[model samples]
Target: MITVRCFAQIREILGCDTRELLPAHTPQCAADLLKVIAGARTADLPKPLLVAINCEHASLTSPVKDGDEVAFFPPVSGG
Candidate 1:
């Protein structure tokens, strides 16, 4: 299973902070994981998402492997 985590506004939007997706769900990449979580809310995402795989920033195209930890959230900006 792939561990998928939601943060900040993303957690609020998705109504959960973390979840596990199975391969049978077709979460082969970060993008696929997003599809699994977003589902009907795909178009409702507040902003572009930032993805991290196993604690390293990665692109949505990054492949997901078993036991990998994936995180999704919005871009952060600061002064």
Candidate 2:
């Protein structure tokens, strides 16, 4: 299983903080896994959210494995 977390506005939008995805096979990368999660929650999610793994910023191609913890959040803004 892969652990996925949603934070901030993303958490509010999705109405959940976390989920466990049982991939048929390990995903090749974080983005791929994101797609799976998005597909599962299509009714509640907006497009183009930011994602991270283990509290570090990550890109679409960031590799992921079973038991890895991934997080997603809306884009941050600052002055």
Candidate lDDT scores, in order, read 0.87, 0.77
List, residue by residue over 1-79, the lDDT tens digit for candidate 2: 8899988877886677889987556447877776676766755666577778888888768888787888888787869
Give the per-residue lDDT digits (tens) of candidate 1, residues 1-79.
Answer: 7899999888998898999877654448888889889899978887678999999999899999888999998997769
Indicate the residue-level lDDT of 16 in model 1: 85
RMSD score of candidate 1 (Å): 2.1
Error of 2 at 38 (Å): 2.2
List runs of model 1 lying over 4 Å from the truth.
Answer: 25-27, 77-79
| Regions of model 2 farther than 4 Å from truth | 40-48, 77-79
RMSD of each predicted structure: 2.1, 2.8
